[model samples]
Target: MRFVQVAQHADDLKRAAAFYAALFDVEPAALFDPPGLLFFDVGGVRLLLEKGAPSSLLYFEVADLHGTVAALRSRGVKIVQDPQLIYTHDDNTLGPSNSEEWMAFIEDSESNTVGLVSHTLAAGD
Candidate 1:
């Protein structure tokens, strides 16, 4: 089987929608207010923001982790952790070999911690 949707806790659909739209730079794909459900497409994966869902720690891959963090901070988003080099992939298992992985954490509108990640070629590669 393949992945389809990820459910994230959202008490206020509109607020969550706005936050995610700014973060992803995309509008919500669909929203059903009767049952309190909102959706966004993230790299073909359905991100479901529902009132009944539990808080989930989500990680998103970004082109520039540091830049994204800075932009979010400027937008008044709470920064949980500054960008830092997290790992260097020496084998092509979790990520490309010889690539450096950088990550940062930020608090979402729903008070959930979200992670941003970026990968780049090692120095002198």
Candidate 2:
């Protein structure tokens, strides 16, 4: 099976939508005012933000790691960690068999954790 959508809890939908739109450079596909829910399009993925708790953790993969991080920072997004390289192995491969990628995390106004990831495979494997 494939992953379809992820729903995140937000204290305020409008604030959350504006924060995400500024960070991702895309407007929400739709917003339900009474329910306070916002839907965002991330390629084929759909992110649903609904009013609930104050904090949550969400992850999104992007192509431009540095640019995205910078843009998010410029928009007043709180940076939890600067972009850094991380390596992992699919299996317990021996010597120099690990793959690497870049990733970063940020906190929304409500202190929710949002991760930005850039994979090596999509950059041409």
Per-model TM-score on C-alpha atoms: 0.97, 0.76
Q: For residues 20-108, could you state the per-residue lDDT of candidate 1 as single tens digits?
A: 99999999999998989999999999999998999999999999888899899999999999999999999999998999999999999
Clashing pairs in 2: none
Name the candidate that leads on lDDT: 1
Each model's lDDT comes to 0.94, 0.76
Report how far off residue 56 is in candidate 2 (Å).
3.7
What value of lDDT does candidate 2 attain over all alpha carbons? 0.76
Q: Which stretches of candidate 1 lie over 4 Å from their true place?
A: none
